[model samples]
Target: MLNAIDAIRIFSGDFQETKTFFVEAVGFEIGFEDEGVCVFDLAGTKLILEEVDLSEPEAAGMVGRFTGVSFATDDIKSTYKELSAKGVHFEGKPETEEWGGAMAHFKDPAGNVFTLVQYPPQN
Candidate 1:
């Protein structure tokens, strides 16, 4: 049975720049690195950045899209401001959701969009 996800891969057109963005800009620590792949240590699962040739049809579609990946934060507004100051391109200011949680979307150097989310306090 599938219990947990060990890693998530983000295919990148420029691996070095994307890896640097996750490290320097997003502050993810490196777990492993090699010629074409860099693995970052996330809270639970690993985030792997794999180099790909965008010229290939299969790879061209893998990048520059909403990744469905969210990074949890305690303070959405402050996190948004902090990341924005570091040249992160956010779609807009963080917005509170109907469920009371807040989220802000930002793009990496490879144009992959990710979310910074703050959950509402639990009762």
Candidate 2:
């Protein structure tokens, strides 16, 4: 059987800038680095960045970054405040989403969107 996906990687225009944003701003810890790759640890998840020598992004069929990543929290408001205080740029304030969750959105420096969700309260 195959295990779940544990790491995600994408090429960046600037590895150091991307690394700084991920480390200082997004709360990921530096895991390791090599000639072409930098790894970051976000709690249990890992993100990798690779260096690409080629340019011409539009013609190269390169995506700016990874697809949106979501995390669930027990208290959406608290998480919002905490991350906000630490310098996360939120796209909008949290609200009742049609999906029946308290939700907030953020976009990482790489133009990748992320969502924080708290499932509908249960009695």
Candidate 3:
């Protein structure tokens, strides 16, 4: 039975640039790093960046896509503004979803798209 997520992986040929993006621009702390793998500590779970050879077509296809990763924040607008000020490129301004949440998308140096989301208040 599935329980919890321990880590998520993102493949990239440009590891150094991607790592810098997560550490500096995204403000993620490096939990560990080796020759070809870098792990960022996202609270308890980890976001791992694995270096891949772009020469291989399948591996190259992994980079630059929607990651389906959404980071939760109390205020989407402020978070988006802060990230944008740091030179992070966002798809557009934050928009309200049908569920009453707010969301904005941003791309990494490797072109991997991630989301910043603010959930509706609890009842």
lDDT of 1 by residue, 53-93 (tens): 99999999999999998899998988888888888899999
Better of 1 and 2 by lDDT: 1
Question: Which parts of model 2 have CA positions greater than 4 angstroms off?
Answer: 58-61, 121-123
Poorest 10 consecutive residues by lDDT, candidate 1: 19-28
lDDT for 75 in candidate 3 is: 88
Q: Can you rank all candidates by lDDT, best first?
A: 3, 1, 2
Q: What lDDT is obtained when candidate 3 is compared to the true structure?
A: 0.92
Cα lDDT of model 3 by residue, 19-62, tens digit: 99888888999989999999998987899999999999999899
Worst 10 residues of 2 by lDDT: 57-66
TM-score for each model: 0.96, 0.73, 0.96
Q: How high is the CA lDDT of each candidate model? A: 0.91, 0.74, 0.92
Candidate 1 stretches with Cα past 4 Å from truth are none
Error of 3 at 17 (Å): 0.6
